[model samples]
Target: MLGVVQTADGLPIHHEVFAGNVAETTTLIPTLTKILKRYPIERVVVVADRGLLSLDNLESLQKMTVGNRPLEFILAVPARRYGEFDTLLEEHHAQHCVGATHEVVGELVWQGQRLIVAHDPEAAATQSESRDKRIEALEQDAERWAGKLVEQETGRSYRGRKLSDAGVTARFYKAVTDAHLGHILKVALNSKDFEYDLDEKALKRARMIDGKLLLVTNMPDYSPEEIVSRYKSLADIERGFRVLKSEIEIDPMFHRLPNRIRAYAMICFLALVLYRVLRMRLKAKNSPYSPNRMLEVVRRIQHHQVTLHRKQSAKGLTTLTPEQKDLFDTVNLPKPSKIAL
Candidate 1:
């Protein structure tokens, strides 16, 4: 799934699901092209995770530059890709940010454009702590399972219960304890599978790798703070995915035919658009109403029954509260009928 996030404001403007084989370099440019064609947008800055980062991908964006107007991108990088990146950790003095220590690394030309690297210290620290906890938890879990494994494998009566030695359970348990300790150790150490690290060295390296993530961007004008903030804000679209799948019932598509699936998705997207519109309108009125709340209100209004008693002329009337009237007006709908049904 691809998310085209708005940077000036936190809103997901476009989204699409694509085939797995299509590279980001191939998909990203066309996606931006289509968005620009349809929407009156300018100089879009695409942000993506580390999976989208590649020298080729960066050059693709660079080649799109026309007459000094280049596409802006903020993408995460793997620190191991550069030895210079490791040097930054020690020499760079971090500028205090929102709970993160940020150091604005000078612009370096990459793929024909000067790219900025923002290094954050506190994130590395927090990441290190989190990795340590996770590794410790994994070790504890493995040890706990190893004991049960040994008992089952040996078929020894523990506390007087007959344990079957030649059963599926026995085999499974034996595999757990007898499996390569190196694999388990590697996981606990947070090092690559084949890389060797002594216990203390492993712990230290784990802290360094865990606590750090990288964001690389060609947009020189954007400050380090804005890059971090906007890149993280992509989580907003992730939240939208949950709302689309669960709240809006977009997934588990009840259709079998490909065309039918497309139709179903379109309908769900339309519903999402309407819900967004209602939410935006309510927010304009300073209403602390969410999309679901606004939907409930509109549903009641939609189901409102009006009784028309034809007096001298046939006219229409609707039972509408003042609040409903204001809401309807805000949404640019026709005023509730004055003529009673």
Candidate 2:
């Protein structure tokens, strides 16, 4: 359950996964080693969400650092551990600052490089709104369930299932069968109870950090602006994921063997690399064609008729249009021969 993202160019530098278990750290290095063995990646960098905020993981990364230099990392600090980040956020908010990005510099115990912090106001606002919607939806589900619970206790019935007017049976079935629904109700009710203070605090914090986003990176040598920009390059991986999920068919695993799964995935990754190279080339040419459409053109060009005639001398001619010629030139393919008479 971990995804490793590595830069494709030169230096296979990549970041390993966070299995969420300290014991799992041992497995991470080995897993990455296996990938490197087959792929021969150099210059590996690791990036992760806050779920990877583990002292042990940092130590592991430090140990794996090669030749007085360890791997590069872009890791998010947990909100609780974000001491400098919190201060920076407050400073930004206090000034009524809008359309501004903040940067903070620091270091970790295991990492030799200083950590750079970046915050994006607009992205943060969008993310916060999305989170709020999810929380609200969860609360609504819980509230609806709680009302049913009351109905069960009041003697109501559904589809011949005896329930109270408050739907006690309905609530009981829901609580028993759908643990997630039950948990949401528990959380919603507890928000009212004020035992954990989680609900109130969550709502408060969401409002407080309305337009703030935080990202911390160990690439201290680079400017905060550059770090933030590079970190956002992870968006490229989303395109790769779409290709894997939609075109490469990583899911619906037909084989049972683990090796087969790994092999299939690796092959898909290779295909994606080639696809990306072609995509970058097409983009450079400013070709007004989607990758799929470009691929269709390639397929068509491959089958393009090339007639050959044998007489005193052998000769061949190919039928290709000006547009096809332009595409071939852009892709660095040889121009087709003229059609044979």
Candidate 3:
């Protein structure tokens, strides 16, 4: 599923489901086209993560137009491209504060975009600590695996029971592949015997780019701080997805038909829209309660029925706390009242 969330309000504008086998990059254009058509806005600035920031997608976005005005974009560049801005990174680091995110802005005329690169010292410290822990764990596991290989080679009781070279290689690869430590780990295999060691140079290079984020945007008129702020808002889209998958229960769908699946997604999208609206209302009013808390309080307000002489009927509402009343007022909703009918 591909979801295009509006950055202004952090609500889903459109969503589309592709075949499970299709790559997320492949769905970007199609999903975006649907959004442009549905919204019919004169201008838009797309904010997306690195996963959707392919060269082809960037070029296509450069050419796209809405009512003859070119579309703008704020896309995240992957950390793998960190070397491309080494000079800028150094310049920024020179002026970087001890615990602040200092922005180093630059332009690439050939690429037709401005770069807003940020370095956060606190974030770097956190990332470095986490990486060190993971590396330590990886090293310990690699040593254990190497020891097992040695046992298999030296144990006479298991002469024919030793693992094959392929098995040992597979185990080594599996250990390092998804751990993001493959580049730093050197694995050697000889028949059933295996050995692994950390490459310090590679580890140092990886750590150099920690806590650095590169934001590229065609909207150069915006200040670096503005660009960084807009890019950070992309987290709202991620949060919306989490809400759909968790609070809205958009997954584990039992529908079999494509139309039914699409409908289910639409329902979830509507629920998210409503959720955002309520959230905005609360935020605007500076309400202290969260949406969930307010909902819980409202849910406790029940209605009761009373009958007199088997003909007269009256409807009465449960007592509303001051907090509940404040919530209703914040949302511009009327409080439930008793009625005689």
Candidate 4:
């Protein structure tokens, strides 16, 4: 697994390479240990998404000491598992923000820990609409399966591989799982028919907290808004990851040994570093070009070579466009030269 740490402005601080099978939650502590030993950061609060939050990881962060004090953290709560926070959220919302149309921020005690909830009415509407659509589609699929099974029982026949009960159960459950409705819908499979049980309570709870984002923080000094904002900044690091995957294409490895993989990861990490730095520079300059666009502009300035007498070569460079020149200046790089240095 490749984990990268970045600053608030999204420039990469460092990256860690681990065995690909390592659990994401388990990597945070080790990665932070290395970063503390290397960087000169005096105060630190780890802001991570829900995927990296585990009870063990949270406990480790709570016990970890930076210098003379315990580590601070703001982590996202997996609110989709609404059983853990449904009542707390209802109480918090009822007592604090009722009928809030925009974002409503509130806090409550969850098993003696501070649970920060941010409710976006707009997001709630979107989530509810999306879930309703998916559930509707799932119900239609279930009906279609029921019709097919009935046809089979009624002595109707067709081509293509017959749909077995096993296959239908697998397919229906997969569709339900892909839609993230497993908690609300249970596949009731029998040898003869495909049916499902809907957990009304789970469905109600999901709708109750559709757009609610739960965050937990141990930083006593930080406010709820601060915790939420810091956690949102993690999106920048996620963007960096997408850049590594799509633009850099770092996968499809042929290496069998660990050390070679590490070297390749380091090289890709350096390239990611450069890409982020360029992005920062371009943003600061208010340039209209993205890093990818800047690269495209740079690529446009091709070089031409001509062989002269005495086997000497003369080179010529295409004239730089105005946008291309501004891109070069923004990136703090010299223009390409026709003459060999």
lDDT against the true structure, per candidate, is 0.58, 0.55, 0.74, 0.82
lDDT string, candidate 2, 1-341, tens digits: 33445463311223333333545445666765566566644666665656665677766666675335666776665655544445545554545444456432222232344444444566666766776666566555546655665676677754765433234334433542443323123332323221111345445444545543345556657666666566566656656667768876667768667667666656766777667676777787898876677666656653344345653433444456676677878867677665443
Q: How accurate is candidate 1 locally (lDDT)?
A: 0.58
Candidate 4 lDDT by residue in tens digits, 137-218:
9999888887887798788876887776778888999999998899888997664556688899888777778778888887
Please provide, for model 3 over 226-331, each residue's C-alpha lDDT reduced to its tens digit, 9 standing for 90 to 100: 8888888888878888878877788799988988888888888889888888888998988887777888889988888888897888877878888888888999
Alpha-carbon RMSD, candidate 3 = 4.0
- Residues 1-341 of candidate 1 have per-residue lDDT tens digits of 33333434434466565554766567777777777777865577777877787888877876774335887788877665554554454333232222444543334444455444554566666766665565565555555545654766676445654433233233333443454223224432232221222266545444444445467777777766677777787776566667778788876756666666666666766666666666667677787767776556656654334345763444444467776676677667786556553
List the RMSD of every prediction in angstroms.
6.8, 7.1, 4.0, 3.0
Q: Which stretch of 10 consecutive residues in model 3 shows the poorest summed lDDT?
A: 101-110
Model 4: what TM-score? Answer: 0.87
Candidate 2, residue 81: Cα displacement in angstroms equals: 9.2
Top of the candidates by TM-score: 4
Selected candidate, larger lDDT, 1 vs 4: 4
Residue 68 Cα positional deviation in candidate 1, in Å, after optimal superposition: 4.5
Better of 1 and 4 by TM-score: 4
- Supply every candidate's count of residue pairs whose N, Cα or C atoms clash at under 3 angstroms: 7, 27, 0, 0
**Where is the poorest 10-residue window by lDDT in model 2?**
188-197
* Residue 264, model 4: Cα distance from true site in angstroms: 1.4
Against the true structure, candidate 1 reaches a TM-score of 0.65
- TM-score for every candidate vs. truth? 0.65, 0.62, 0.81, 0.87
lDDT of 3 at 110: 27
